[model samples]
Target: MVSRPHLPEDRMLVEQLRLQLGNIGSSVIPTILLALLLVWVISNDSNAFAMRAWCGITILFKLYLAWDARRLLASEISPERARRLLRRKMVINAIDGATWGSLAWAALGTTTVAGSVLVVAVLAGVAGSSMSSLAPILPVFIVFGAAELVVLGAKLWLMGDPAYDALAVAAVLYTAALLGQARNASRAARRAIGLRFENLELIERLRVETEHAQAAHRAADEANLAKSRFLAAASHDLRQPIHAQGLFLEVLARSQLSADQHDALANARATWQASAEMLDTLLDFSRIEAGVVEPQMQVFPLQPLLNKIENELAPQADAKGIVYRSRETHAAVRSDPALVALILRNLVSNAIRYTEQGGVLVACRARGEQVLLEVWDTGIGIEPAQHQAIFREFHQLGNAERDRRKGLGLGLAIAQGLARALGQPLSLVSTPGRGSVFRVALPAARAGVVAEGAADAMPGPSRAFDLRVLVIDDDESVRTGMRQLLGAWGCVCDLADSIEEAQALARAHRPALVISDYRLRELRTGAEAIAALRAEYGADLPALLITGDTAPQRLREARATGVPLLHKPVLPSQLHRAMSAVLMGRELDSSFAGLEARRA
Candidate 1:
């Protein structure tokens, strides 16, 4: 057997004592019974009383040893105490062994040869059986067996017969063999005990590690939740001013201004548009997470959608001095056009943003029953390892400084999410330095599916509505801006900052259209205000809910209201279209619906 380092002295002493004492009871009864049998076998009439006396003394010593074992077992075994008890046990066992050995001296000459042989046989049987019980503490077993064997050998050597002298030498040899066996047995027992301690140590270490891992997991979850809360709060607070500014900008654009003033207004508007786009991306993600983005599946020609994306994002590529091209295709496809447009827009924009000198290409290819809408770009291409990570929210490549101009690292994430919601497949192939291709597998227009008309038509100039519009908002700036903007469109505006005021205004003016901010004062939502106004007016009253909340739960709550919802920082054009749709008693203009789908 391979050997291990010895156990600590204290633990080894305690364990040895426990094993030695546990086996003592079994040995005691057997030893006393054998003593009585020896007396019957070897005692003649004259020595019978002396033999019975020796037997009595042996029983007394054995009983004392058994009582000592029981006492030690009941006591707490410290290292020092265990050492003392073990020594006492070994001394007692030595005395008992010598007493049994004395029986050989007394019986050999006094009894018949047959009876003498029985005595030898009994001693050998006792020594052989003791290896199992006595071997845990090797010194105890050695002292006991040696005391008996030495006494027997010495007494037999004193006999004159050659046969008796031979028996003495045989006793010496038997002693060597028994001690060897006991040593092996003791080593095995100690090794087994050591292994048990090792296993217990291992189990304890694992338990500690598992506890640490669970704590880390909990910490990560809490951090993520905290981040979500912060983003929601920040998105809402930031959007209020931007939304107010956009309205004021539209109102300003209607007034007379110098050429340079117009240029500055244009720059301000562009900056506002940038902020609005980033916030919109966040809203899109929240909507997808809330499971509010349901794809409006229909067969539509792919060319119009591709053309629109090119028209919108082509300026960005031109600004970067890179050619942006699209391969025209007449092929039709079945999917949510708004969502697909969002996906393609993100891909095209990303390609332009990353590419320094090379152009981006958008194209479509037939793949059996699916059409692979591919975006090819000669950008600072992605590494193969980062292919999946780029689609994760807030993960960016080559933008460690986090330049906001490059975009919030959410475009690909929003694209991937919308694709999954539509049950379409999106994939990427890239080389580290050359270029990349992002493919979105859209189901081809199937047989028997009627295709929707995909044509671009411009809305005519806005005419005076001559309608009374009630605007509800908590912010003073927002309320003022809404009033001015509405007045610009030739509509009479009644503004209220609270639900009570909004209801009062509704009753007083009998508004033709209701426009309310989603979140209001007193922790009451705009949905509640809309409900109150609708209750005051009639269910047929047209209403629009505008909110800046990007929280997933807020998105879900707003969507559940069944009132047409528009996010804050809504451009004048988008707001007009939504109001027009409501006023005309039509489903929101396809543009507004498309905007809503992108938000989803």
Candidate 2:
């Protein structure tokens, strides 16, 4: 029976049944105490000594049952195996009960009326308790109870004296009553055990159901993650040529043309830039949700970031006649300045985008050890119920037709995610007609020159006239496009499809600035290519990496290289700014942690 495979569900029931058996076995220690009482009352004689030996052995057997019951309960004992142990215990109980019956006969000579009564009472108690303990196996209980009664009743009837004669008749009647009590106790015990096992089965069923539900949820999450990864991989490949096309358009812009041709080219550039922005938005959302946005936390003043945001978005605000204002504060904050700027940018942009006529105000104030940075705008305010809905991806207010001009409804969601990543809280307060105030609470840093930037040493627009720039990109069209763009800028340019080819060109020309695409052919990278070129020429090589990759690992790797980066589809102005910064060896945006680290 023990060799049979135990069902997983049955293990709990079996363990509980074993526990019940132990409780029933442990309860019998009181019988040992009762037997001790009998020993104290009986006289010290040869007959008494015989009863003492019998009682001592019986007490030892009862202690053995208690010891064995604990050992079984301590482990996972199968029901079939446990029942076998139960049978062994019942055998011991039968022998113990029979011993009690012989005691009355053993002490017949020395036994007084009171002594015999004590002995009979102890025997009856042990028999009754055993009946309840072994109730599940009625045959065992019958064996134990019958042994006690027949031995004691026969001994009493055989004495054949006047007092003994009446007592023997009473003994028979007493045994009958005790047997009835045992039967009742047995039924009650069986009913209670049945209910306990039923409850255990119900609990087991619920546990299995919960595990299945959890497994399904995990599978669904994994599928979503896979889709995000595929989009990231595809974005890198798509951006390369579009980036080249944008650079080619910049070259065309520098060319002299009629007003009509120039206007047509400008419109084409706008469409290309818009496409790049849309792709970038999707990439940013995926990176943030995938937990790839690692913030470069630093102690930086709020004013510089705020000023840059206002200056950058001023045109958009101006076009709508919405007054965009910034309240300057000399407050320094300990946070990722880039991320904080991103959060505020989203809030201000949303305010301006939703508003038809009213202005927007960005204010920073110190509150205790924290700074409350807020963007308050008199826009088309959100309804109370739709406040939370606005922060969800692709969720918009009043854009039922899904107009692309209003932008994807992911700006607030990205802001919220970035705030949480920075260990700050972002909240919104708004009314239907009043306006909305988007706020971020950040830890304030000690005000000092640590937030200040050093003066740039670059000789402005009047610097050097003769500059050679080397461009290495694996994409042929991008390489051709960059060569044309740089030639149009009146700079000596060297273009190549690989580092080896670029190195061959570098040896002949020894170009001053290196511009390389982040990902190259044969699993090589722009950073690696730049490092090798710099090793041969000069370690202080001014280089910039252009990439369209948005995978978290790849982004971190590019950042680690400490080379300035520009995402693909770079406009002519952005390209020139990055170039000027790289040549002069300082970031144009000095407020960012990247340039500050380079300076340090």
Candidate 3:
């Protein structure tokens, strides 16, 4: 047969017994001393009836002490019941005090050896009775007390006349030792109680901390979910106008006009460009803050990036009659090319906008293990105090009226964010009313590879193309603009405003490429349009989806579809690049199919 396991109730009982022992130990000496004193007084007196009465009172007092000790033990073992137990114990203590007082009177009235023995027996009985309530040891305690008395008497008799003095000293020492043991036991019990209280306090503190941490985690999760929803909705909503604007701009750029008219158109184009830049900045800042813009580090030549900056900013500086110059250096760097280019663009744009006279100069120089790309301008330089402030979002130094036309003051803020994202340090030094220099230090790359042609420079004449393209969007203006732009690019353009429209177009004429907006009217989306087109034609249609939403959910949805994604407002050059990539892929596939056909 298996032995039964100990239950929690069993453990509780054991703890209760231990606590009783501790309490008994604490009170034993005092009770013993009172007993001994009463006995000594009774032995020295001479009253038979009074001695018997004193013995009875002593027994009553000992019984009260036993009850009080039991209550104290109960309180220590289980504090939940301590208040009730303590009340009972206090009552018992009161009874004990009264009984002891009565016993003292009886001791004064009686005198006999029998009375003394009776008093001693009563005291030992009381202590034993307290212990007996917890366990079975009352008889043993009474026998032990009798044996102690017998030993004392024997020792006194053996020593004869001198033994009387020795016996007196021994009695005093025994009483003192019992009192000291009781005091020490009480102190130990109090220390244990204090430790238990401290443990309870610590547990409470840890419980509160755990609750706080859980609350924080819940709040963060909610915020993230909300952010994902916002990005999805915002991106879908914003992309429509951006996509339309891009296509419209492309159509405008292709239109023939006089130099004066072209200049006006250019200003209009700049306004669109600035608006697009602001949107891009907002999107990028959101991405960086959300920890989505992972840096793609690669070894790329720096000179080409600098050259692109010069080409892009030259016209703006010229319009302001400010000179634009770049000091070329043979340097390469390992960094995120796209992020670095963004940083440079913002710096160049700021320099062109602020400069009134001399001009802006961009230069690169070797500095130890890093290359410093610096943009220096002779403009309204920053005050030493305002240098750091300029990098904060939407901050402008001058009057609102004067700086209002320049654009939202997010350019520097975006530049700084991008710099940090790429793990590069961007620093500024300026002299008020003189000039400012903004420097970005990047890790240097090995000096062997040739630079790729500058991709950011203004595009040259369009290349001849015979590719067929389909444009699908819910917006009429977007479709019209795309039609005109693609027509100018030498591609036969088919426009559709819905999935149904796209399906009709695909059946009538098999298009080589499909470019669709993410959000459409009547609850239709770009993915749905692509699916419809593919169903009508084939699954192998080349397609690209464009959106302005920065929401993670929308991005995830787009990513899951395995379609090429471009954010709006799309630049003419970016559109061209995307188109080239799609066309190149289509050409390679066609060539492979032809080769397979011959083999078969």
Candidate 4:
């Protein structure tokens, strides 16, 4: 009694049974044809009726097996049912093998040696061909082969001849070889099925992980957008009061005060300046992240920019008792000059802040078609591992205490952002306990493309103006503060809180300059107010837009007006410079050139 195969894997058992049974139908016609051929070859006149009857029985058995296979395959088979079906199939296969084996005895008993040879050949062919379909269940193949070989071997041995006995032994050995091959084929099929299942499991796992990653990415983007909206709202509210205070303080400074009073006033002003600078840094970062900072590319001489940076920042280095020098370069570069200047200014200011004793050098040298603009500083140099970290917003080196005077850690971050926006590469080379060099690679302009001109310098002093100025703002304190500041500067001022009011004032006074807040009451923008005033006075009338909005949409909208925009909490001197630029029809001063660059 041969044991049934123990396939513990339920899926594998079902798959094996399905494969074995599915192939049963194709073998039916071939089996019937082979059986008829065998009868023709073995039948004599005396054995003709018996051979024909055996052929009919074999044909009936093949048709029955094929019908049974179709019944099993037509429905979904469970593992337990497959096991039971496997047992029945083994018994059926044994009957099939034995039926073919019966031909062996019938052929040898009545026919010649050629008939026996033909029967043996047919048996060997059937046994070998059945392995592919039956071998998945090793026990079925074993029993099937055993039953056929047992019958043929018994018939051969009972012939009472040495040649027949040897043939019986050969048949037994051949059956063993077929069984061994069947075991290997079963294992190969099992391995292939198992690998297929494992791959499906791995693919499912990857699909789940990918969905989780995509969900996380979308969540992060929404959170970032929310943060930007909150920052813009808070900054605008904060700037209103701060802007009012700065103007009031400037007006207060021009008054006569005792020595101690003057000292206290100066301290208060310095504190206000620090807060304003921090807000400005945040504004710069917000604008870059909002994708609102547009670069105005142009070809310009490098010497004037270098000279300007030295003139502007050398004092800070001098205050620290550290020498500041910028090497003159006639090499011209094609880039956004204002943005490039901002990048260099940040680098120079950062260098000046860090260096305690040695000088900071601003140098530029040509390398092929590019110019390497370098800021060399003899400061507390950075470690190699932290080179990339320093460019991240608010990431500081050696400023663990976050000293406000050392400056917010956004300078380098802003520089890197602006450099990327301009498509220039900014890189750093540093060694711990030594100096560091920050280099910007700018594309050099073609020869004769750069036209040299005197750079726009900040106005020398606050010049008194006899012109009439229209100031529009919804905030009352802001209006009062502006009125006081402009009155001190000898300007006739007309203030309004709405566009209708501003137009009414412009009609009465016909102001020379129109200064308006970007956001006003009744959902009116200062750009609209400025346009109304320009319509009243003339299109050529000078106009300036002041806003504290850090929101990307508002920033972009304000910039599209082609008007000079200044952020709130503006220093008195910055306000003076902007007014002078708008009056003279020259470029606005560097104080708000970043905003002016947006319009360009």
Candidate 5:
């Protein structure tokens, strides 16, 4: 056993007394019975009184040992008082051993042979039981056992018989055995205590680690929530000015201008459009992550989807001197078409962006009940190691200079996310310097499955802009910008800041269509104003509500009103198209209806 000097002296002594407490009752009972037996077996001679007196003293000493063991068990066992307890218990046990040794002297004075043997055997029994009781405190048990055994040997030597001498030698061997047993038990007790302390330390460590992990998890969740709130607030505030600017820019585009100013304004508009597209792309990604883009899964033709991607990305490919091809197929698939289109668009855009000389191809092949749509590019083929890494956000290849024209390295990542959300298989196959093929497998539509069509959000026929429009916005800048743009489009505009003002304006000169900011004065929403105006004017009064909030809950609340929702900064053209639709008593196109899903 390993020596544990680090074990406190008082702790060891206290624990030993505790063990003695349990053994006290049993140990005392057997010894008491033996005392009575010894008295009965002794001779009734003159020395008989002496023997009985000694027995009485021995029984009294044994009782005192019992009392001490019980006291130690019941007491608080403070360290300062422990030394006194240790001495008291050891002294009592030692005196009891001497009392028991006197039994050998009493047994020798016995008249009959059986009486002497019985008395000696009783003393031997007492020594063995004492060994067990004092096992935790070996030094004390050793002292008592030695005293009893040595006195027995001395008393036996005086008996003068050779056989009696041999019995004395046997007593010596028994004492050695008792001492050995005490040592082994003490070692075992200390080892058990060591293990207990070790276990406690280990348990404490695990508890600390678990607490740290929980705290870190909570911090991360709080940080993510904070980030979402900030983005939502910033998106709203930033878009208000941007929306007003876009309207003013459109008004500027309509007026007569010199050739130089026209070219400059055209460049400015192009730049603005690019920035807006990036914002929309980022917002779309955020919406999907926020669980706001609940896909309306259905069967849609692969050909129409491919043609859309081709038409959208062809101009970019042509500008890059790359041939773009999409093979027509009646292959239909069961999935969300918008999400699928989004996935394909990113893939095609990435393919064109990466390729310098070669062309891009879009084709579908049957794979059992599914169709694998592949976007192949002859540009720079990806390395085998980078095939998976390329799909991670902000990871790029061969663009160490960080060119903006090549995009922000989110195309493949968004594509990967969308494909995973749709539960479709998207894989990449490539060999460096040859080509790369991005493949996605969609469930093939059954023979009788009818695909759903969507209403396009595209603007049509701007000549029908002679309707009376009411614009409600808390911001003066937004109201002025709206007035200028609508006036340029030849529409009469009435403006207000609150629902009451809007109502009064409408009552005086009723608006043919209502245009309002989503968040109006006094914490009232545009949906409420639109409803109040329709109630006062007519049930068929057309209305449009615009918001700049990207918060998922805000978007969901806006959609809950069954109004076609548009996020700011809304381009003037988009507002015009929505006005044209709403004035005709129609919501946005079927396509945007699913995309926006707020149209009643």
Candidate 6:
């Protein structure tokens, strides 16, 4: 058991008492002064007994006020309790005014002082009723003055002594005017107290709400950090098997075997490809969660990216006996070409995975100032309730029964997150068992943009990388596999496991291309490696960064360096494509030469 520090009880009690005393002293002082004035006016008659009786009443009233003050100073009171105390004080003051008024009328045969004091007490009562009901005091004052005059006239007629009659009338008038002023002052005081109390209540409420919000935000931040650490660790471990498998596959692809053995190897390769795709999706989802995925804003023809998706996904759709097609009336848009491709890839892949016999269609239409890129499929559609849910992490609808082999329900989640990060909105309309349409609506970019070398357009196969390429990463398997893949594309390959080794290789080889992993040993990263390479080789040395880190800050830094980036468990085709696009500055095929030429 742990011992906790303690606070002294006496100190706590003294602080509590100080707060209460401050409140009570402010309310009671004014009431006591008004009571004394009432007693003085009533005692101004000739009878000795009446004068002594009025004096005794004044003394007792003062004593009661002092006792109430002492009670308030002895305890702490909350706002709710303070409100109750104010109500009780109002009632007590009203009773004191009624008692003094009754005695003065009985003794002097007039209701002069009694009427005026009664009006003031009633005004205080109105103030105490609630914080906002103090408007009735002015009318009550006017009535009190009228009633006082009637009573004074009756008293003069009954006494029939002209000597003191004028003096009595004058005194009654003076007292009435004084009490009227006091009533107005008390009303103002009550209003001030009410406003102060309301402010205190508001402050306390806001404090509690702020604390609660801070706690929730802290919890979310901690969860996100833990998730990033787990993904980094898992990606590191998963790469070892993937690297080994890639090496074995390359060896198999090169050997001459019987036709049956070759077919078996192809099946094995398909299974490996599927496993790799799942891993890639998981890594991407983690990256999206960490907010490391950034959009590269460039004006590329929209047709080429959509065509790439069509080529990539058409085979899968055909194998499943489902038709796949794309149509876009507006062919050019300014945005991150790679990010848009990724979003479309996921949408088309998901469409094919769910559709058993029917087809999938990708199309675009202009909506106001935006373009609505739509992917529609005749698959098992989502329930309206699950439309938004499916976009959340690890969410799947009826996946247990359908195609668990296709994926782990992360494709749409990644797509939605990427869209949001790129400042686009991805929305869906679906009915269970009917078809679904998923749309990515983005703002239109400027028209007629071009990349480098637009004048001399040539029609040819997309230029392949013919330059020397260097690969640097801490993971040996990843480094070896990348070296083999690049070497297969007819490019000379140099490999390193750290920045120091990369710098050495850059100086010795002066390679035409550089590729490095984002995370390395001792908190060093691929960005640092790229920086070192740039310093040794010139800054415009055509470099690319490969990373498994999904943190937003790292992504921003990578983007700031103007380097092409690919997240890990890198697909063979995506790697080949990214390399060609960055190194040659040409579109993939002759048909698409016009696309790149227009962009240039």
What is the overall TM-score of model 3 with all chains considered together?
0.61
Q: Point out where model 1 deviates above 4 Å.
A: 1-7, 12-89, 92-129, 151-168, 448-466, 536-538, 583-600
lDDT of 3 by residue, 502-571 (tens): 8888888889999998767886679888987887777888888876666654555655566676777777
How high is the CA lDDT of each candidate model?
0.83, 0.74, 0.65, 0.84, 0.78, 0.64
Of the candidates numbered 3 and 4, which has the greater lDDT value?
A: 4
Top-TM-score structure, candidate number: 1
Q: lDDT-based ranking, best first?
A: 4, 1, 5, 2, 3, 6
lDDT winner between candidates 3 and 5: 5
The TM-score values for the models, in the order shown, are 0.84, 0.71, 0.61, 0.81, 0.78, 0.61
User: lDDT of candidate 1 vs native?
Assistant: 0.83
Tens-place lDDT per residue, model 2, 369-461, is 999999998987889899888888778888999899888887899889889889899999998887899999999987564534422112234
TM-score winner between candidates 2 and 3 = 2
- Candidate 6: where is the Cα deviation over 4 Å? 1-57, 60-64, 76-221, 255-261, 286-308, 318-337, 364-372, 400-403, 421-424, 441-471, 482-495, 500-514, 533-544, 561-564, 571-600
RMSD vs true structure, all candidates: 4.3, 7.3, 12.0, 5.3, 5.2, 10.7
Lowest lDDT 10-mer window, candidate 4?
591-600
Clashes per candidate (backbone, < 3 Å): 1, 0, 4, 0, 4, 5
Steric clash count of candidate 5: 4
**Local lDDT at 386 for model 3:** 92
Compared with the true structure, the alpha-carbon lDDT of candidate 3 equals 0.65
lDDT of 1 by residue, 491-550 (tens): 999999998998888878899998999999999998998888778778999989999998
The regions of model 5 sitting more than 4 angstroms off are 1-137, 147-161, 314-328, 350-363, 374-413, 425-439, 448-463, 488-490, 507-512, 521-524, 528-541, 580-600
lDDT score of residue 173 within candidate 5:
90
Q: Write the per-residue lDDT of candidate 5 for residues 234-263, one digit (tens) a residue.
A: 778877877887788888988899999999
Estimate the overall C-alpha local distance difference test score of candidate 2: 0.74
